[model samples]
Target: MPLQDNLSGYNSGGSDPSLFFLSGIPGLEAMHLWISIPFCSVFAVALLGNCTILYVIKTEPSLHKPMYYFLAMLAVIDLVVSATTIPKSLSIFWLNSREINFTACLVQMFFIHTFLSMETAVLLAMAFDRYVAICNPLRYTTILTNSMIAKIGLVAFARSFLLVVPLPFLLRRMPFCQSHVISHCFCEHMAVVTLACADTRFNNIYGIFVTLFIVGLDLTFITVSYVKILRTVFSLASKEQQLKAFGTCISHLCAILIFYTPVVLFAIIYRFGHQVAPHIHILLANFYLLFPPMMNPIVYGVETKEIRYRVHLLFQGKSF
Candidate 1:
C-alpha cells in the first residue's frame, strides 16, 4: 500500500488504529532524534567492548578458558542485539521515523527476541560454569572441556534461534486490523501484537506463555543454580575460595538484576500504573535495551581480575 493512503486512519475517532500489520507509532521524530545519541553511543561501546573482549581472549592463551569463552559469546550476542536495533533507530530519526514496513518490523522482532533468548542461555551457561568451578572444582577441567563449551555455545544459539523464529512468524500471520502507531519507539512483540486487527487471544496467551517459558524458565534455572552455588560456597574450606567464587559471580548477578528488573517493573507499571509518563516509559524502555551493553564490559572488567588486567594491557599498549 502507498504510504499516504495507507496511513489515513489517524482520525477515525475510535481507540484502535487502521493498519493490519505491525506498524510503529507516529510523531516520534523529535523523540527519535533524542534517543539516537545514546543509542549510537551505546552501540559503539557494545561493539568495541565486545570486540575487545573477543580480541583479548583470542590473543591471550592464558585467558583461554570456559568462562571467557562464554563471556565472548555474550559479547557477540550483545553486539548483535545492539546492531539490530540501532540502524532501524537511526532510520527512524532520519526518515518519517514511524513508518516501519511490516517486513522489516518482523525482522527486528526476530533478532531482538533471538539475542535476548541467547543472552539468557549464555547466562545459564555461565551459571553452570560457576557451578562446576565452585561445586565440582576437582573435575572443572574435565567437566567444561573445549568441546563441551563449543557444544553448549552451539546449543544456546540454536535454541535461541528456534524459539525466536516461531514468534515473528506467528505475529506475521496475525491480521493487524487496528493501530499502526506503536506507542513505544521500537517494534516490540507485545506492542506489535496489541495492534492486531484480529482477536489477539492467542497472541496474548502465547506471549505470556513464552514469557513464562523462556524468561521464566531461565530465571528458575538460574535461581536454582545460584542456590546450589551459594550452598557450595559456604561449605568451602578457606575464605579465599569463598571470596574468589563470590567475587566472580557478583558481576553476573548484578547484570541479571539490572537487565531483568526494569523489564519486570515496566510490565507492571504499564499494566497497572495509570500515570506513567510517556517519556519515562520511553527512557526506561531504551534503558532496558541499552543498559546491559553498557554494563557488561564494566561488570566483567571490574569483577574479573584477569579481564581487568587484559583491558589494562590493551590501554597500556595503546599508550606506547
Candidate 2:
C-alpha cells in the first residue's frame, strides 16, 4: 500500500462500524474548501465536455462510425468515473461531511475499481479499432461491425465486473478495528482494506493479480497495435501520407498516456514508496482520477476534426 499506517498492527479482531469517516487528505483538512474549488471546477468541465461529446456524436450521422462509437463509450465511462467519486468527495470538502456507511463505502470502492478496469479494456478495444482501420482499411467496417462493438462492450464490462466485484466482498468479511477514518475522500480499496483486522493477504494478492492481468495485458496489446500501426503508416509512399496516417492516432495516443501514466506511477509508489506521506498519496490519487475525465473530451474536441467542427457550430447556435 502507498499509504503509511501508524496504527495498523494493534487492532487484531475488534471491528465495529456504523460508518467510516472520509477525509479530503489526512493533514490538509483545514484547506479542503480551497482544494475543492479546483476539483469542482474540473468536475464541471468534465461534465460539460463529456456531455457535449455524447450529444455531438449522437446527433451527427456523419460522426457515427466504429472510431466515434468507441469515443462515445469513452465519454460515457468518463462521466461514470466522475459521477462515482467527485460528488461525495466534494461533500467531504465543502460540507465537512465525512461519514460514509460501511455498505456505501463498499459500493463506492466497487465502482472505482470496476470502472478503472473497464477504462483499460475500452482503451484496448479502441486500440484494436485503430489497428483494424489502419491495417485493414478495406475491411475495417466488416471487421468492427455494430455486433462486434456490442460484444466488445459486453466483454469489457464483464471482465471489469468479475474482477472488481470481489474487492468489496473481500473487505466485508474483515473487521475494521483500527480506525473508522479512511485516509482518502472515497473508499479506495487499499485504504478501506488497511483498516481491517483480519488477515488481508488474499485481498491484497487478488488486487495484484487483477492489476497484472488486466492492465498489463491491455497495455501490451495497445503497444502491439501501435507498433503495427506505425509500420503501416511509415510504409506509405509520400511523407504527407505518412503524417496524415499518424496524425489520426494522436488523440488516442494522448488519451493512452493520460490514462496509463498515473497507473504506472501509482504502481511504483504502491510497491516501493511506502515511506511517502499519506497526504501526498491522497492528493496524487485524487488527481489521477480527475485528469482523464477533464482532459479526454478536450483532447478529442481539439484533435478530432469532425468534433471540432460540430462544437464550433454548436457554439454559434447552428442547428444540428
Q: Model 1 residue 99 lDDT?
A: 57
- What C-alpha lDDT do the candidate models reach, one value each? 0.76, 0.87
Q: Count the backbone clashes (under 3 Å) in each candidate.
A: 9, 0
Model 1 TM-score is 0.87
lDDT of each residue in 150-265, candidate 1, tens digit only: 99989988887876777788887876554566665577888788776688787778777766688888889889999999998898889998898788788789878867887788
Best by lDDT: 2
Q: How high a TM-score does candidate 2 get?
A: 0.94
Model 2: per-residue Cα lDDT at residue 246: 85
Q: After superposition, how far is residue 293 of candidate 1 from its true place, in Å?
A: 1.3
User: Residue 275 CA error for candidate 1 (Å)?
Assistant: 3.4
lDDT of 2: 0.87
